[model samples]
Target: MTVTEVLRRFNRTYTQRIGVLEESFLGTGRPLAVSRLLFEIGSAGAVGVRELRELLDLDSGHLSRMLRRLEDDGLVATTVDGADRRRRLVSLTTAGQQAYDDLERRSDERASSLMAPLTPRQQERLADALATADLLVRAATVRLRQVGDDDPVAREATRRYVAELDDRFPAGFDPGPLAPEPDATWVVATSDGRPVAHGGLRPVPGRDDTAEIKRMWVDAGWRGAGLGTRMLRHLESLAREQGYRRVVLDTNGTLTGAIEMYERAGYARIDRYNDNPYAEAFFEKELSSAS
Candidate 1:
């Protein structure tokens, strides 16, 4: 089968295996949607309605309907936040707690039963695959957008990036010479309005046809999700847009993973591109064409 067909088949099988199409999930007499909501609230003890909606990626009307259904069933209660009257908090009612506990118990049992037929090695591989799938799904949801140099989220992400470099480098690092230039383009990758990765392209000194990719960083938790590759490709595209024919970047030798990624992305090793004291490796890549 083709890749798309394979993915669709997996999706169908996984959903069916998880009882997603069933009218009653975990014998709770409710669909998976509301049961999930109850489970979330129960897990958190209490959660803001806005947070719930964002966490579930549910539209306001759909979330309202779900909340109403749970409320009607006496499984959850909504109360106005004392600190913010405009916001509402959802918490499980006594009956809701009972239902949530039952759901959790049944879900764990179901998972165990499903995995029982698998060999130990197969089970481990399945768990690893599921974890990879979850990370890739999260990576796909991240949004990349250009922002001004002074954007707060971008600044915060840059700060985190620098701190990480200091932690990773053999000697502590300095950020003094890495200031953004007026003509540079900055890109930030965000998930749920929080910046999770950053990269930028700046003009090479006295060079109109070439640009430098700088400050490429991905949040630690987001590292293995291929966000770094996404950010690199994004910066390259931005460089192409700005009329640059080539892009260059430098990294510390301690960043073996980054070095490997750069090589895989077709960045060729080049001579020292700049006088950055911390850089131990440099790379360059020529753009195919600017769209």
Candidate 2:
């Protein structure tokens, strides 16, 4: 088949296999936005409004209105925060729990029905492709939200990254213990709410606001999916926002793809500036005109 025909077939098969056309995919006649919020909040017995806002990317006003309507409909109950009375905590009522479960069942049914047509082998391949695509698209869509150094997910990604570096560096790699208080602007990349990629920038000691990128890593199956480029661009944008005119990064020669990506993305070779044992190649990209 021609390449265009192959792509068309792939797209057609993918949407059919993934339940993309289901209108009642979540069990509620409500919009997917509200149903998704209900499901997420249902998973957590009591989730903070602020966290709901961030996790769902909902406007505070809109989320508040949704919560209010849910409350009036006796689906969810809201309470004043113990430590901060002005803030609210939302929890599903028993009635709301029933509704959430109904929605969950319908979602599971629709998903199962989508895959029922494929043979076992075809199902496995489809599932694998979807998983990989989800990770890659998520890496591309990661919005670079500011995360504190102390966040557990941030620390976990750092540990995973450091472990990979240790394997790749001929000189052996030790990025020191996970430093939770580093003056870093960190971001965690999540695919379907699971962290899959991470990179960050922090002060380069006496260089004022100069930030060096560190702990850059993407999950194993995600490497060649353009995650390196996305993470680097995100780190650079964040560094520039924090008054950093230049960004520096270090990597090992064993990571040829990363090296190539950095060079093509505007990083120029520079002398190694740190004692990081893993760093065989150092790069710097000036960002005076960064957005």
Candidate 3:
């Protein structure tokens, strides 16, 4: 079967196996969504309604309804935030706290039950597979969009990228000479509205059909999840949209992961293309017009 079909099949079975489709989750007498909301609020102590909505990717109206239900049940309390009268804050009530503790205990018991039938080695394999799946799923949900270099999120991402490079490169890295040009296009990848990866494409000096990819970095937490490849592909697409037929990039030799990624993505090693003192390796890729 195709990978997509297999993924769907696994998702169906996994959700069913985990009791996610049941009206009562973990014996909480609440639907899966409500239980999850309670867990989030309980863990956070208190959370702003807007923040909660964003965290859960919930519709404002639907979230309001759920909060109302919880409030009516005396399991949650909502108050106008003291610091921000326009915003509402949600926190667990005494009963809600008790419920949260119960949910946690029951959740652990359910996990133990699931693992009971498996051998120790099989349990370890399952844990490792679940971790991998979680990372890949989170990575897939990250959003990539183009923005100007001066955008706050873009600038923040660039600063973090430079800081990381400085820590990794033996000679230390500097951002003074790496600022993107005025006409450059910058892309940032965000998960839950927080930037996790950033890169840019600028016209190569004296090369009409070539674009230089710059400031490519992925947050350390997100590095091994294929986000770097996704960012590279995005930059290539942007370059093609801007009428460039080739893309080039430079990186420090210390960044072996980046070098390997470039090679895997069909970038060929080339002679030094720029005078950046920090760059030790250069690579280039030809892009199809339709890319």
Name the top TM-score candidate: 3
lDDT per residue (tens digit) for residues 1-291 in model 3: 997898899999988987899999976899999999999999999998987887788899999999999999999999999887998999999999999999999889989998999999999999999898888888999888888888777888988998999899887877675554798888998776568999988898799999999889999988799999999998999888888989999998999999999999999999998988888999999999654
Model 2: ten consecutive residues of lowest lDDT? 18-27
Ranking by lDDT: 3, 1, 2
Model 3's TM-score against the true structure: 0.82
List TM-score per model, in order: 0.76, 0.64, 0.82
Q: Report the Cα lDDT for candidate 3.
A: 0.90
Write down the worst ten-residue block by lDDT for model 1: 172-181
Q: What RMSD does each model have against the real structure?
A: 3.9, 5.7, 3.3
Clashing residue pairs in candidate 2, if any? none
lDDT of 1 by residue, 258-282 (tens): 9999999999999996998999999
Better of 2 and 3 by lDDT: 3
Off by over 4 Å in 1: 42-54, 71-99, 137-142, 147-156, 174-184, 190-196, 203-208, 219-225, 269-277
Candidate 1 versus truth, CA RMSD in Å, comes to: 3.9
Cα deviation at 155, candidate 3, in Å, is 5.4
Candidate 3 lDDT at 180 equals 49
